[model samples]
Target: MEIVSFEQLDSTQNYLIEALEKSQLQAPLAVIASEQTGGIGSRENLWHSSRGDLLFSFALPLSWLPDDLPLGSSSIYFAYIMKETLIEFQSSIWLKWPNDIYYCENKIGGVVTKMIGKNLVCGMGVNLKKNQKGFEALSIGVEPTFVCKMYLNGLDKKPTWKHIFRKYKLEFDYHKNISTHIMGQKISLHNAVLCDDGSLLINKKRIYSLR
Candidate 1:
């Protein structure tokens, strides 16, 4: 992946999406910034990332993944590769179902993936170090650029969805007690079921991560 660095950016996700539309950027490209002023989350909620934190977005060719892959589970696959990358740095980050990165009880980072025509765009934010008053940070001594490189290396393998899903399901226990929102309502994952495609089956309804 090619790295395009910025001292400041409104939103790497939006910038990358627009760049892709204009053909100004190529696939397997990343747009990173020291801080983002207009960060967003899966919901309309803001993802407030501080300076010195890891904030970036990467776009890859959709065809890089398997054709049979379920679109809803892209978050799970992307988060899994990132978690695997961090693990090599000795960071004990666990992925919350759907794709939030948590360190123990506090969230240290997260990832969200979206499709733009033939490209797959993923926005990621990790708190590498914390200020006195802020969300928890990784403190793993790993640089954001190194993390990006590691993620790209793992992604180069193009692992199948089935392979990632099989491993991710085993880690669902980490999220058993966490709270997740569904349709703007607070809900618990204690009774949720992890499907093959990474969707949570709650009350017999298949809740897709992408939505």
Candidate 2:
């Protein structure tokens, strides 16, 4: 994958998406910034971050995705892999159901996805440095660039969906105490059932992480 790094940017996702749309860049490419001024979040929200946050967006061909992977669960798939990457550094960060990144009870960062033509673009914002208030930072020390490179290196191996799902299920229990938003309403995950395709069955209503 080709990676382009910047000292600062408004939003990596926006820049990458526009590049792809204008034929300036292609899939399997990544854009990173040392500081993101205007990051995006799920539901058209803004992902505010400080100087040392891990801000990046990468695009991959849809055909390169695992055959058994469900489109709606792309956010979880991407987020879990990143959570696994952080664990390699001895960090205690865990992925909340769907896409949020958490440390114990506080959130440290999040992942969001978007479809651009035949490619899938995933944007991740992680707090590796303690520069933001209210939100907690990562538990371990790591150079943001190193973590980004290592993550893409691991992704190049292309683990199967079944493999990631098996591991993610083991940690699904951590979400029972939390709640998630669905159609503008917050719903508890305590009774949410993790389906084979990664959707949750809450009160008989199926919910997906289609960020």
Candidate 3:
């Protein structure tokens, strides 16, 4: 995995896309930035990226994955893999139904996936040592690159769905057993549902979907 680090950037996702387009580069590229000024979030929200946080984006060609797997499932698989990694450092870390990483209740990080031509770009932001306002930090300490390398190394092994499923199931179970705190109110995890189409059902209402 090739890593390109920048001291500062408007947004790691935008920078990565531009770099790939400019270079006509294929998939399997990573872009990391020390600071992102205009980081993105789901639904056009701004991703608050404070300095010292982990901000990175990577792309993979669609051919790298199995054709039968839906794009939404792939994102869920990647999110589960990442949640498992963070659990090693912070056991309190829980996955919000789809791809948001939460520390107890407050969001600590998130994952975003976008399709570019026949390729897929997965962007991740983690609040390691620092966090912006309205968010929480992991109680346990971790190196930014340490987490990044774990993901990249796993990818290097070119794991199949069978290999990923074992880990995904375990993390999904853990997520299910946990409770969710929304807007300062505690709610049971049973109210959350993972729909067949990869959308999250909150109180029987569809909420978020990877697509």
Q: State TM-scores per candidate.
A: 0.93, 0.95, 0.79
Top candidate when judged by lDDT against the true structure: 2
- Model number with the top TM-score: 2
What is candidate 1's CA lDDT for residue 46?
Answer: 82
Model 2 lDDT, residue 74, Cα: 91
Model 2 residue pairs with clashes: none
For candidate 3, lDDT tens digit of each residue in 1-211? Answer: 8887888999878877876777666578888888889988755578886766788888888888754456766666667677777877777776665567888767888888888777788888887765536466774566676678887776666666556655555555666866644434565666576555455567666644452
Report the lDDT of model 3 for residue 182. Answer: 40
Report, for every candidate in turn, its global Cα lDDT versus the true structure.
0.83, 0.87, 0.71
Worst 10 residues of 1 by lDDT: 84-93
- Give lDDT tens digits, candidate 1, residues 51-129: 7788899998877777657988888888888888877765567888777888877888788888998998999988888
By lDDT, the better pick of 1 and 3 is 1
If both were scored by TM-score, which would come out higher, candidate 2 or candidate 3?
2
Ranked candidates (lDDT, high to low): 2, 1, 3
- Model 3 alpha-carbon drift over 4 Å, by segment: 131-134, 161-208
lDDT of 3: 0.71
- The superposed Cα distance between candidate 3 and the true structure at residue 57, in angstroms, equals 0.2
